[model samples]
Target: MATINSSIVIISLPAIFKGIGLNPLEPGNVSYLLWILMGYMLVTAVFVVTFGRLGDIYGRVKIYNIGFIVFTAGSIALALDPYSAGAGAMWLIVWRVVQGVGGAMLFANSTAILTDAFPVNKRGFALGINQVAAIAGSFIGLIVGGLLAVVDWRAVFFVSVPIGIIGTIWSYKSLHEVGTSTKSSVDWPGNITFAVGLTAVLAGITYGIQPYGGMTMGWLNPWVLAAIIGGLALLVVFVMIELRVANPMFNMHLFKIRAFTSGIFAGLLAAIGRGGLQFMLIIWLQGIWLPLHGYSYEDTPLWAGIYLLPITIGFLIAGPLSGALSDRFGARAFATTGLLLNAATFLALLVIPVNFEYWEFALITGLSGIGSGLFSSPNRTAIMNSVPANQRGSASGMAGAALNAGSSLSIGVFFSLMIAGLSSSLPGAMTAGLSQNGVPANIAAQIGQTPPVGSLFAAFLGYNPIESLLGPTGVLGSLSAQNSATLTGQTFFPELLSGPFHDGLVLVFVVAAAMSVIAAVMSITRGSRYVHVEEAVPEKGASVPQPSTRSV
Candidate 1:
């Protein structure tokens, strides 16, 4: 439920914005759009490690149960939102942060719980199923959100309530911690620096994509630079603090494990590519392909999700099997090969036209999914297995943090790359298309001058790009009905978009492929299959466990 809710709101954004009485694609409102999309992720990314450390100091199961309760409460609050416009958006954002806190708890500790439940050799299969379930939830959430949000926007939030409730009950009733715990005081300085620093960095990146003054992106903005630079400075301080502190929130020494460190880096890169792909595909499907194929704007979200099922099929096929196989064969080969395959898929995507055949699109994306499944579990197993038993909670948290952070970063990195591509080409296309479709040259130029991010957001949120572009200026109303219909028709905007969107796709996919390839390089360098040796704890005194690897 935690992971599923992450993507659910994305597909349902059209209904959500409409229900809240806000135009998210408008220049002034774009920040709201970004925050709504990224806030939960940003919050979760920053705090997962802290919660993981807390789980270590306290108990994993106890923290996880609390997460379910908090998450359900947040869902209820979201469903019951009583305001409209910005106030309503704020309400949702605040509650979403609440949900994020709960999500971090669950994400950080769930792996530790799984590791505790499973033996060493079987850990790969268990983690595989768990990781697959999480990724599947993200994919499935798109379809579920579209269906529920169509009936009522609130239904999207309401849907999580019952599931959260059931999960809460089940976790509390059945889960008991069997894993070792570290009895240490909370590292307050480390916690404060890490949370605040990572939050600043991620939030800065999130806002960095928004327009500032005359620039298409806020990279030039003083505030953005400050946030990013200041965040980095604090992170440096965080590292120093962690090294000196007796009980650090994140164990700095964990980086010594080649498998764990490499897995985290490779996984983080893969996540950036994967998360960016999700958003890009959503825009591609909802903005261009579905409408071009004659689906109504309102129906695009649901259909887009449906079209993405082939990717999930690929995941279902590869995830568990790879996990089981990696247990015997070692993770290095599977993890490296999977990402290399994903890189090939990225290259494949670049060659496909913007208006691609469904089957061709499916085949490429299915291969991408297979690549993801092949890497996810084995990488996770390697990370978990490479850490000492007592640090499992922290290890899990770090892994979760890497995943969420990569996802959060994708919004900035991929979108900025696409925005750069669009900035160069989209203006001419928008101007020419609008002018030809009965809009005045001056007005068309003005609309064309608007940042390309708006167009991307409009399409991503399932709004007809031309309608949103022309509606406010009354250009559509002024034109002859036939001309207006033609401009707003299924075909015009997508056809107008095809060339420029293709340029954007090339930029985005090329970067994504490069990331996958680099991640593959990282995966291959992780040495061999090995699990960390566990030391027996003495009954009375503190046990100093040696951190050493044992080939499994």
Candidate 2:
């Protein structure tokens, strides 16, 4: 449920915007669109560590139970949004953040709970299933959102209510606190610094992808620069505070474990690569490929999700199998090989043309999914196994933070690269295309100079790009009927966009391939599989046993 909710919003944004009467392409409302897309992730990334620490201090089962109820309430509130336009957008964003809080609680503790329940020998297989579900939920959410949004926008949120309720009751009744809990005061200073710093950084990155002044992106905006720099400074201070705190929200000393540290670094890199690839592929399908192939803009979202099924199938097939294999062969070989496969597939993508065959696209993406599934499950198992039982919650939280933060960061970095690539050649191509289609030369030039971000969003949201761009300027009304019809047709904008979009795709895929190679290198260096041993404690009236570290 946690992972599904995280992704469902991506494919549902168009329907939701229409239902709420908001124009996401408008300059003032772009922030609303960005917030809806990114706020849930930012909040979850910021809070998971703190919540995980809370699980360690209190009880994982107790916190996890509360999460389901909170998540259900947030879903109910989202489905019942009463306003329209900006007000409605705000209402949904706030509740999405609330839902994120619930998700953070669950994400922080779920892996730790599994670790406690399964014996060391069976842990890789168990964690692989759990990890696959979490990763696969993202792809599954895309299809679910597409299908449900066609019927009613509210159905997206409404579908989660029943599931949340059932999960809540089942978790409360069945899950026990099997892991040891430590009694410690909350680390206020550390929590505040970490939350504020990470939130500021991610918000800056989120807004940085939008246009500012005459630039295609907001990187030079004073607010964005301040947020990024100031956030980094605060994080440095946070590290110092953690080193001195009596009970830190995140234990810095966990980095001393080679398996834990190496696994996390590799996971973060792999996550960024995977996240960026997902966005780029969606844009490629919805914006250029599907439209060129006769799909209308309004129908692109659903078809795009349907077409991406091979990637999800690969993930489903490889995830559990890799995990079970890693249990005997160790994580290093499987994880490294997976990342290497990802790198090879990314290189393959770079060579494929924008208008390539569907079978070729599916095969490459499916291999990419197989690679990611192979890496994620074993890496998670390795990290969880390397931590002492008492610190498993905290360790799990760190892993979640790495994945979430990497995803958020990927959007900012990859989007900036694509936009930069587009800005150079897209304006000239668009101006020529429009002028040839009977648009006045001056109007065509004017429209061409406008930021590419608007066009990108138009395509992403399944809006008719030419109509949306030219309608407000009254250019469409001035054009002849034949010209206007041609401009607004499914083929026109996509045909114009293909060359420039492919230019951007090349750069994005190359960078992704490099990141994957680096991740593979890191994965190989994680050394042999190691599990930490916990000391035994007396029964009845004895004090809680302190976990000792002995990794082997």
Candidate 3:
């Protein structure tokens, strides 16, 4: 339930910007939109390790309950946001960050609690179900956001309120600690450095897609450059500190275990490919394709979610079944093969047209989802199985950090690439299209050159760019009513943008495909199965119990 709610917020965030009457493509507006969408993940990534360490020091269940409360409060605040543009965005951003802290607590401890509750032999099934819920929640958010955007944007946030309340009460009443606990000093220095460094890096990436001065992309912006460079430098220092600290937040030596390292790296890379690709696909459908195909922008979000059901369907079919099978056979073959299949699916997507046939697009996406589901369970189980019970909390946090960080990176990189591609061709195309539609040439040209990122965001938010650009004061103001109406009509702008938009999409898919292939190759290098020697036990009836069989 926590995973579902968290993911719903993630999927719904971009759409919320549009609901609040902001253009997602415009630099100022896009900045706010991006922060609102990525802030939760950013905060969650920064705090998960710290919270995981706390789970080990305090009780996991105790911290997890507090997470539920924080998340619920954030949801209520989001539903009640009273301003627009900057103030409204700040309110959402602050609350979203708080919600992320809650999500981190839940994410950091849920697996630990499950590991304590379930025996080793049955852990795969439990985790698989949990994984399904997480993925399902993301899809559910898209559907809900689309449906509620028509009634009121606030409905999406409110949806979580009742659920959060129920989940908090239920979790408090029923969940308890069955796992071992240990006392350790908090790694305050390590925590602060890690949080600030990651925030700077991610924030830089988020803004790097926005326009700066005359440049369409912010990568050249001095502040953004500093953030990226500074973030990397601090991370280097963080590693050095971890090696010397007694109660290090992150264990540097875990990479010595090949299975653990490979699993984590593969998970991170896959998440980078998947997370960004998901958003790009949603924008393609909701912002451009759906409107061009006859669905109103207002109706696009719900339908886009419905169209994406196939991906979730593929996951539903594969996750539990593969997890169950992995219990008997080692994860090596299944995991490697799954990633290979995933890489192939990415290549297939690269070749497909942006305005693709439904069946073809659905099949390809479903195939990718199946591959992801196949890889996830066994890979996670393998990593967990190879670690000592005492280290699971920290180990799990490390794995999760990789995934979350990869997701943030993917969003930044993919958005930059898409914007770059669109900027190269969209202006000329938009100018021509608008001119041909009876708009004045200068006005059309100016609007076309308004930066492709802004247009993309406008579509993402379900707002028509023509409406925003021509708002009563621009070129449309001097024109006859008939020309203005024709220029700003529902079909005019969507039709004008489709060609260049499709071009941008092709580039996005190619990048995703390459990333997926690299991740697959990395997964293959994990090598044969091995258990942690420290956890191994002597034969039964011997003087000492075997370390591997320490369940009792």
Candidate 4:
């Protein structure tokens, strides 16, 4: 519940940044921009394993109750931020980090709490519902953010405050302490190494999208290279430490289980396939296609959400049903099929133009959503079920880490691909189209030099680029009135960019399709499921190992 509540805040971020008047393109604001956009996930990824270990020491309910309070406090802080634009972004980042900490507490233990409360036979159904709620909440975040960003950006943050307060009180009053606990010293080496390593990797990925001087993207930036390589090195050290530590932060042994390993990989790949698709679709519809089709750019955000409703609807229909059926039929079959369906959907999208008709987009998106829904629930169930009752908390946390990290990683990869495609074609296309439309040769060339990715974001934010392109001194004065009007008209920029943008979209879809197919093949290799340790043993009478009891 707390995690879902935080998701609403995340979805509202683009509008929040816009409302505060920060230009998304400016490097000065990009750090804060990413913090607001990805801070929650970064914080959550850093803290989830740590907190899950803590829950094994302290009571899960105790940590969860505190989480509710912390989350609410963060929400209130975000709503009350006093600065404007860049300064406002800083304030929000601080509070968002706080919220992520609380969210980590909630997410780390939610599945374990359910596992402790439910019997083995009933665990699948219970976790399936929770999985459904989580997916639904992400979709709801978009709609809620759109509505609130329309009314007032602060309202998006404020909405969470009230819900967090209610959840805090409810958690305190109703939830009971049920999970086993131990008292052990914190694993500082493991915790610090893991945090620093993951942060470096994620930061590197995020920065890779930004343009470098004379380069389309920052993949070769020295700092980016250092961060990524250093992060991986630290991760290797962390793993070595884990093997040596008496009380490791993460149990390296968990990967030995076939179901557990396959499920985690499937979750990661599926997330990679779908995570950026939402952002891409929204940009395509609102920033480019919708404007060309006569809808004012300002109205695109809300309509983008509405038009994407079919995808969410498809998920709602498929997730729980497949989850339920998977318990009977087994996860391997359903998960594999879902991946194949998802791959097909992406390939189908590859052939369509960026300015495709509504039905074509709706159908493809809906199909992809169904595939995601089908994969998510069953895959999660498999991961959770593979563990013993006592290890459920850590197991679930590991699974979530893969999903969240893969998502951030996906954004980096897809954005880089799109920007690369645009860099090759957008500048030339812009110059030719502008010159043909009677723009001065020098001005057209200058505007062509402007980063295409920034223009994409401008359209996403619904800004009138003419204001940015021409200063108040009026560059248009030199041009004929007819030329100026044609340049500033709604269709001008969108129409010009459509062909180049379509090329980029096709490239991204092709890559996504290939990845989805690989995910399906991996999922298929998982074979059949097994019941948790306490409930059943093989008919051949082989013994399942019980997790040895230990202090946290």
User: Which of candidates 2 and 4 is the stronger one according to TM-score?
Assistant: 2
TM-score of every candidate: 0.97, 0.97, 0.92, 0.93
Query: For each candidate, what is the lDDT?
Result: 0.90, 0.89, 0.76, 0.76
- Compare the candidates by lDDT and give the number of the best one: 1
Question: Hey, what RMSD does candidate 1 come out at?
Answer: 1.9
Model 4's C-alpha root-mean-square deviation from the true structure amounts to: 3.8
Model 4 ranges with Cα > 4 A deviation: 1-14, 464-466, 472-474, 535-552
Candidates 1 and 3 compared by lDDT, better number: 1
lDDT string for model 2 (440-525, tens) is 89989999998988787776676667887788778888889888889998888888888988888788888988998998888888
Ranking according to lDDT, highest score first:
1, 2, 4, 3
- Judged by whole-model lDDT over C-alpha atoms, candidate 3 comes out at 0.76
Instruction: Kindly give the stretch of ten consecutive residues in candidate 2 with the minimal lDDT sum.
Output: 543-552
Which digits, one per residue and each the tens of the lDDT, describe model 4 over residues 13-124? 5678777787766657666766777788778877887787777777778877788888889889988989987788888888988988988888787777877787655666
Error of 2 at 222 (Å): 0.7
Question: What is the TM-score (0 to 1) of candidate 2?
Answer: 0.97
